[model samples]
Target: MKVEKNISLLPYNTFGIDAKADLFIEYYSLDELRQVLKEHKGERILHIGQGSNLLFTRDFNGIILHSGMARARFLDDETVEAQNGLRLDDLIAQLTDMCYCGMEKLSLIPGEVGASAVQNVGAYGVEAKDVILRVNTLDVETLEERVFTNEECRFGYRDSAFKHELKGKYIVTSVVYRVKPGDATKTREEIIETRNGKLPKIGEVGSAGSFFMNPFVPEEQANALLAQYPDMPHFETPQGVKIPAAWLIEQCGWKGKTLGGAQVWPKQALVIVNANHATAEDIIALAAHISQSVKEKFNITIIPEVNYI
Candidate 1:
């Protein structure tokens, strides 16, 4: 484990923003994590994995904790236990090759295992919460280890308890996922093709996948909008009617638009890319502008899916 001071966050976040962390620490084992937590009891901390789905808005005035552990083991023919720091795609590849079913739809999604349960990461109609059997965590306040079943995680659309009511209360250590032995090759290929068509390649462009969550609106509001835009795509959810944020952004005339190094990707309006050497402020400003335009045009508010640190 290494402890460093004033480390650049550019390498730690997907946005490529050159923010700094006051202190940066890495732990390779549970004992090392406990040691750091015990010694730095009251210090502010932010945990990270692969630096995906987040934007560092400014130099963090706290410690950034990262776990170095990465491992995955099959508990049986149909279940797997994976350590938190494992690259999500690596795990998916291994399981798919093993003929593990149901995970193929999530192939190539960015981020790590630890974030799966926290973000309830979803794509192509499948969500992490759907496969998660349980999540293992260490309670930072009491240094006690605990487990939460899928039901206890309070899984919702692109949300989980870890992100809301239980935010910052626990540090995820591992996750147990349920899988099956079946051919997943065809489905995986299709999902990949669909994503590649709309999303930028990871290293080729700087982005956090979808920048905005699809906004849900009441039936009346959706019907009103549909009257004007009969072709506007939507899905009905228990919350309300889910409106595609991409369509709204496109209607506001933001596709491929640029501002201060940030640009709405030409291929996908839901994505905001670091077109140049974008400062954190540049991305923030561009996002704000896009959001404002959508609000004015549709009378609907779209929330950011990316975490701002």
Candidate 2:
């Protein structure tokens, strides 16, 4: 276990926020994690992964936990169990190298295995839930391990039970993913190329991937919007008509637009980047402006996918 006090969080988050934390702990084993939890029983604790999907609004005043146990092992020919600290993309790359075919579409997505399960991170029509078989977690109160099957996770578009009813009650320790024997190099390469072209490179640019979730509107409303803009893109699903938030933001003339030190990514309007030493306030203000414009133009309210810490 490694513990530090009053540390800069710049290296931890992909957004490059310079926030500080009162306490930062990195546990290398499940036993160490349990010990930490037991020691800080009633204190506020936040378990973070790569911090890719988060925006630290201010210095954290409580414990911030991270895992240093990154490893993956094949459980059988078709399943693999990966520790929480393993980078999701790194695991995918390794699997692809070994000719695993299930997770190629998710290649290059930022975040770790635990956050993948918590956020249900998705891309190119594939979601973590689609490939995840089970999630191994630790009950915060009891310090006992528990396993949840995929269906028990109750996954929704880019969301899961971890973000809601079960929030803070359990900490995901590892995830088991289903795979098959097939060369996925081509698909993985294409995905990486596509993402690299559209999304900002991590470390080079500060961003939290997609800033907003695509809005789902009723069929009638979608038809109404389509009438006004015939070229509008949409898809019908069991939930509703899913309209890409990127298109909505672009139509509202937000592409490449800047506010304070933040800017809407030119290639992908779905992303908000810290263009030049942007403060959390600048990013939040810019997101609010974009959301308001989209809401004004179309009666749909787009919500942020990034969590503000």
Candidate 3:
């Protein structure tokens, strides 16, 4: 429950942005977090796990709670339980070794287990909500532990109840995922094939995955765009057609474009990478410029998937 004052946050975030926090503490257990919360009763708090999905806007004025406890175990024959602090990439690797197929698509996504369900993080056709059996949370208001089922999570396209109704109301402690046991070699081969002929590598660069969620547009609008660019990728969702944000961004000539020390990845238009010593403000400005250009050209406003604190 020890709190450090005026902590530098340069290494905490994936963007490597320089920022500071008035109070910062690393909690290794739920009891430690409870005790700290009781002692600092009136302080504003921000819970962070791996700090992948966040951008610091300025020096924080409140407490920063870093979830540092790491634990994972097989709950049963078809379920695995993991603490909030477990890295997403490590979890995926372990699951793949165990012949669990559903999480391989999310192999390269950054962040911890706790943040995955918050946005229903997805890639290549699969989403976190698709395999999550339940989420264990500590209610901030009542300080009670509860397990929410997948349906209760209200998962939508890149959204869930955690981001809407329950935002800032609970701290996710752990998650249970439903997975299957099969042949590891076959699963690895399938995943490798689906990677667009790329090798399986980790920690290649600084990124938080796709910066923007794919924009959902009406069928008519999607059809118009499809007619214009026959190869534009899209998927049919219940809402309408989910158009790839990368397509619009590439069409607008933003790929490989650099602003200050931030640049859109040349290979993946959807990813904004830290080309050098990029500041959070630099990345934010580049994203805004890209979004504005896309909107002006395509009449669609792109929504960022990353959280700005």
Candidate 4:
């Protein structure tokens, strides 16, 4: 276990916020994590992953916990278990190199293995829920290990139970993902190239990959909108008609637009980038304006996917 006091969170979050935490701990084993939890009982605690999807609004007056255990192993012919601290994209790269095809579509997505299930992260028609077999977590109160099946996770579009009823009650320790033997090099490379071209590179440019969740509307409303925007792109799903938030933001002339030190990514309007040392308030204000414009022009509400802390 490693402990630090009055730590700057600038190195922790991808947004590059310089927030400070009263206490920060990184545990390398399950026992270490349990010990820290017991020692800091009743104190404010926040568990973070790669910090790719977080926005630190200000200094945190609490304990920040992180996992240092990074490892992965094949459990069976069809499953692989990975530690929570392992990078999600690194795992996908390894799987693809080993001729595993199931996760290639998710290549290049930023975050850790633990956040994959919590966020139900997806790209190019493939979601982490589609490949996840089960999740292993530690109950915060008892420090006991528990396994949740895929069905029990109750995954939805970019969400799962971990973000709701079970939030803060359990800390994910590892995740088991389904895989198969097949060459996925071409697909993985293609995904990596495409994502690199549009999304801002992590560590180089400060931005959450995608800032807004794609809004879904009733079929009737979608039809009405289509009559007005013949060029609008949309998709039909069981839940409703899915409209890409990128398209809406672009239509509102947000692409390449700047507010304060933040700017809407020119290549992909769905992303908000800290192009000029943007503060959290700058990013938040820019997103609010974008959302407001979309709501006013299209009567659609687009919510941020980034978690503000």
Best by lDDT: 2
Off by over 4 Å in 4: none
Full-model lDDT, candidate 2: 0.96
As for lDDT, the candidate ahead, 2 or 3, is 2
Q: Every model's Cα RMSD, please? A: 1.0, 0.6, 2.4, 0.7
Q: Give me the displacement of residue 237 in model 2, in angstroms.
A: 0.5
Instruction: Compose the digit string of candidate 1's lDDT tens values, residues 1-309.
Output: 989999998788777888899999999999999999999989899999988899998889999999898999988877799999998888998888888887778899998999988989998889998899999999998889999999999999889999987888899999999998899988888888888888988777889889999999999999999999999999999999999899999999999999999999999999999889998899999999999989888989999999998
Q: Per-residue lDDT for 1-309 in model 3, tens only? A: 557899998778776777999989988899887777777767888888777777888999999987887788998888999999899778888877767766777765668999888878876678999889999998876677889999999998778899888987888899999888765556445665665343212244566667888899999998998898899889898888988899899999999999998889888888888788888878999999999999998888899988899
- From the highest lDDT down, the ranking of the candidates is 2, 4, 1, 3
Winner on TM-score between 1 and 4 is: 4
Task: Flag regions of model 1 displaced more than 4 Å.
Answer: none
- Which prediction has more favorable lDDT, 1 or 2? 2
Itemize residue pairs with steric clashes in candidate 2: none
| Residue range 95-174, candidate 2, lDDT tens digits | 99998899999999999999999999998899999999999999999999999999999999999999999899999999
